[model samples]
Target: MARTNDDVAAMLEEYADLLAITGGPDFKIRVYQKAARSIGAHVTDIAGYDTTELRQIPNVGESIARKVAGYLRSGTVPQLEELRGRIPAGVRALTRIPALGPKRAMALHQRLGVDSPESLEAAIHAGALHGLPGFGEKTEENLLHGIALLRDAGERVHLGVAMPLAEDIVTALRAVEGCHRCGYAGSLRRMKDTIGDIDIVATSNRPKVLMSAFVALSQVTEVILHGDTKTSVRTGQGLQVDLRVVPPDAWGAAMQYFTGAKAHNIRTREIAVHRKLKLSEYGLFDAVTDELIVSKTEEEVYQRLGLPWIPPTLREDIGEIEAALAGELPDLVTEEDVRGDLHTHTELTDGHASLEEMVAAAAERGYAYYGVTDHGPKLYMQQMTLDKALAQRERVRELDGTSGLRLLHGVELNIDPDGDVDWPPDVLAGFDVCVASVHSHFDLPQDRTTRRLVRAAEHPCVNIIGHPSARLIGRRPPIDADWDEVFQACARSGTALEINAFPDRLDLAAELIRRARRYGVKFAVDSDSHAVGHLANLRYGIGTAQRGWLTADDVINTWPLDRLTAFLRKKQAAGVSRP
Candidate 1:
């Protein structure tokens, strides 16, 4: 079976974890981890390459390439199997708990005989875990909370995690000789934050050939079924991908039926039924005459139903169908509409790229402006002190006009638990823009969190609120807050809320965006990029905006450079300096 880049990366990650657990050489552990990182970030299919080409990848050396080849050819690596035998799989799972690292988990297994989340939870509840080295009552409490969140999060894969694998599979299907068209359906097409399974639809004359090609792809680790028109397989990342081959004429109807929010389809069918028309995966037909009417394209289907074409991202039956009927459907924000990125980082703090490199990447994307907003002092580990911030500001000023792209010097100011900002007014005033965000106290009471956010929005120097919910998908729940009040506060203070585009942190989720829109609050769809490759994350943010029914005019970053600067200056002029 063909293994995707993610598949190889997952195996390497497992090897690294096992090595760490077994007290293997530090250098070997680091090598596996680095190789995993590099492969996971790679855009192309790693399994299609020969051993020599694999070795050419940045972190893949001779040993790693050989291991990859061995795994791809057979099913398992001998060393990895041996390590698994030495360490129970349960012990590895224990390391995933919030406060537990491999070292801590191993110590627990060796001393307290704990090997899984169940056993650890038992120990904590029995008060047997409190006095352990590096662990206390507070740590135990935190672990319990983390475990609950993990349980609640369940097995859903983040959209970011599943998208690349889905795209690769679609590309492979499209390469089949008889395949006329191929694309993913389901929630992926709808752009949901999390996905349970991937659904792909293809139009092909030779179903068997397409099915064979799909099942034989390197990413398929297990074939669940292979039939004339459908095939299902499980990828290395544990994602179930189901492919359906349909006649070319039924492509549109099949796509609409499969790419469903169920409720949306039900509503559409209701309209068809009322109009004496029938709708199904086959085609739309006149119910009385039993004659086919439309099926070739989705737009034709919508037109027959007296509605305009609905973007896939808004197919959730969340007022989209109604909007279409009224001809009020929004011209949703697209990647091309964004003129700049306002929340980004560089090497002056936690980012990997330099200021100039980041600017060049933005310019390559045709962005007229890009903001350099590194972490502020309160971030501690990656904090930029006042003097460092000033020096960076000067550096930005000196290079401002030299680059074709306009650079905005800014800081991601830390918002404290009680609603205090990291920097004083005068310091914040020196920057071109200020993005205030909550970095700590994620578990505060709802009222307190709302108050904290409201205070930040009310701050005169604050131009935008970054990652309003402060969520790390699959890892942490969103902070509790009165979202309506917070949205109103931002609108009142003219503070734009960010739709942080980082895959792991697409904050101000689609539902919240819709709610905020009611208050006439503006938004900024930002990449929150730290590296050059991260600049491409802007697409995810744009999808989120479209899902929320936002248009280009509703997002500040979509405005031209002059309008954006004028808005920032207006906010700064009204800002009150702190004592």
Candidate 2:
């Protein structure tokens, strides 16, 4: 019974959240919350230590250490269990809404008997919140929007969270003696932004051994189903995973069937039917003879149906079947096509890593060039001033080409409500590149918001529009805009739209990217990285680009260094002298 830092942290946070809902003393509650954070963030395992040793962690006193020992011993203490008995779990779940706090969650429960997200939504729609203090008509609207956000995120985990776990499991299982092939499938294999569940497919004769190994995985919190062919388990993060063991001969067919977007699979089955054949998870077979045709590879199956093998990303049945029939499938972009990251940060702003460290890391990635686009002065709390910006520029000049990477000094200028940027022409012209983004004013009416974005894109000094939609996946809905005008402005002004790669804000979402492409607008698949490690998020961004049907030619970052810099020079080429 070993516990990772996240495991301990989650338990502590849950206890603190429940405590707040139960109206515990403020000081005591604060003490437990602080201790929980300390234990969760500690570099070493808290379980291996005695109570006295545990006290070495910040904020953990004798009492807190005893609680930690209790948690490690049986996963909970008697005190926490007693509190859990008094509070319904749904009440705790209510606090997950963005603006809803523990106090309000409790208020809803006691005042209106709303204890869950579903009940809370019902209350909002029924206008039950109107007369309550601090709850207005606007509040009601926002709550409804919040519920939709929750629903959009329903039952699915972020690909960032699920992919690593699946990769780990697949790697381990592939090493087992009986396994012939192993990999994750479903929407995860399709590279969807959010995944419903993880599916692992393994081809083996000894299904019993595979099931035993899967159930015995250390990350498993609960085992729901266990059998020879299929086994299901729940992880500590509440993600469900299923492992299916099939015969070695059925490996290719199982991979294709399970890796499916249902509509795409339906199209394949339809083709099979027309060809006087049968297609199933087990294999493909002849209709009349009932004989196996092709089940050894996806390519073989697709070839038998008169088409080339389609990339998993394009298997969403969105014009892909027709394109395959015409032999016009796009050669989608890949991580190797990207030359460098354009939107990154350093310690001068909100970034955790410094210029030198970030530079060395970029060099390690073998980037042809890299851009340091720290927050401009408008962000305020980052304390960026003209002096600081210039000093960093001097450093960039010093480090340029020192490590096989040509560095560019840049700024992520904030676009204000009126669509104005942080600096005047000369100041902006000082940087090698500029990326503008909307940081606030998310609730503007459609026409006004559209005008705001168009103005930003048409700025003479702005080289790129960063995270155009400003949506935080499941947390914030995309702002309403007449997007055709936005893309047209980008095309006219030579301002590339960003495919920001931060896990939470994979901005310029796939649907919009496709539309923008139709406008002949180019894109930069930037990591939008704040730390060196954040650069690896490029894979997710590439996934999004492929989903949008983007090719290497559609992305400006895939160009050679000279071509990319020429694209960045649109500011100077605009011939508009700023006042």
Candidate 3:
């Protein structure tokens, strides 16, 4: 409902893509992209800033800063609008398809008058593309496949984009006088990787008072529905938000009902039915007489139903009710359990923040230890070299224990197609941590993918597998691996898998984390952060880990520094080479 960094970055990035499609200069295109990244990663919101203040964001030069200021002040940039008017929207839409860059998009529009995916597909099928330069038969097939992938990705917004907006609304409404309670629910509360919409619940004697504030808020662009009980509104960005008000006594039941997967609510209602009780948003009541039994707290509702309160993340009807019945529900990991973050970046690589700024942020979060794992050489665009990495490590050492945050000088080593990492054994051994990850070769066959990841996990130099699936939510699908075998390899190798909390990439997804935990594979809940602002993404990682049923015991970053250091040295203890 509110403007986010994602919104700003997306607008600027679209301008860049459209410029490239129009034969804009390569260097200029790169400038827009870089400014998009810097502005998106800036710790503070740029919406309130003037041109001078906006220029503080890296890569936002005089001209770019002025454009950003224009956007913030007037909600549009003239240049971007002019470009949008010139290009057919579908031409820009073509770039969203995998393997279809701006060049291909432009070619499609120019050669075949295929301005959209539908037209492009028709052109391909009508054999209109047979003799085109890059649109061969194989390319057509791949294009069709890419279109299907894009379709399946759907239009869900990333959790990163939705959470802050919802949190802002909750905070604002909670301050209204006479408001009894306020919180957001639904899948956002469940901490899903993406969100379709947001649900907020509140209790107040004056329903009109809350509804007035809800629809009147600056975020609400259009009032879709208005009623005493519920109100729905659309944001300028088209995210729908529903606000519901109930009596104070119905607060708990209302929250539980709204914060639901259909399966979970059905199961809870069935439990109530079995006990000759009734469960509804109003309260748990006597099934026959409708006498309210419990309506005040979620714990009481679950207690009356002969179950323990399940965490919102586990309310997916995935054996959570059964586990609760058996008193075997997991002590799920919480944000507080995280004592440090093991995967983060700096200006040394792709991150917008410098080493000191990132470290200061970590210290502010009261982290006991933080690993600065910048990109290594294979991510060539970063131009990271041994000399650069060493220089950063030296700075990290200088900063360690300076502000009560122990710094682990680390590198995010790219796992090559052959399962080898970026650095040689001697070089890798020098770092306090080596987070090996798959940066490319995402389309390898399942067998090769499985073997590749397993080999990386078992590598003595590799400590954590960063974003193991290498997924980008709706953008890229996870690697198809025989994860059971890989998990077994990691367990035996004492290699920890990372639960990257970078919103779009909540990698080593919940299902994989659960499966890996069965083999006793430990995990690191890390904010694969690229900015100072990104450090807060760890909460999403914690949610992801909880959904996977991880306890603090299953996560290495939750351990005290001594134990974490010992665990990091496990590969060294194994007496191994890449030696």
Q: What lDDT does candidate 3 reach at residue 368?
A: 94
State each model's C-alpha RMSD to the native.
19.8, 19.8, 19.3
Tell me how many clashing residue pairs each candidate has: 4, 0, 0
In terms of TM-score, how similar is model 2 to the real structure? 0.73
Residue-level lDDT tens digits of model 3 in 109-154: 9887888887887887799988899777888988997787577653
TM-score per candidate, chains pooled: 0.73, 0.73, 0.73
Best by lDDT: 3
Over 99-152, each residue of candidate 1 has an lDDT whose tens digit, in order, gives: 578888888888788878888889888888767898877788778876775565
Off by over 4 Å in 1: 1-154, 575-579
lDDT of residue 499 for candidate 2: 94
Give residue 46's lDDT in candidate 3 (0 to 100): 63
Worst 10 residues of 2 by lDDT: 1-10
Q: Rank the candidates by lDDT, best first.
A: 3, 1, 2
Better of 1 and 2 by TM-score: 2
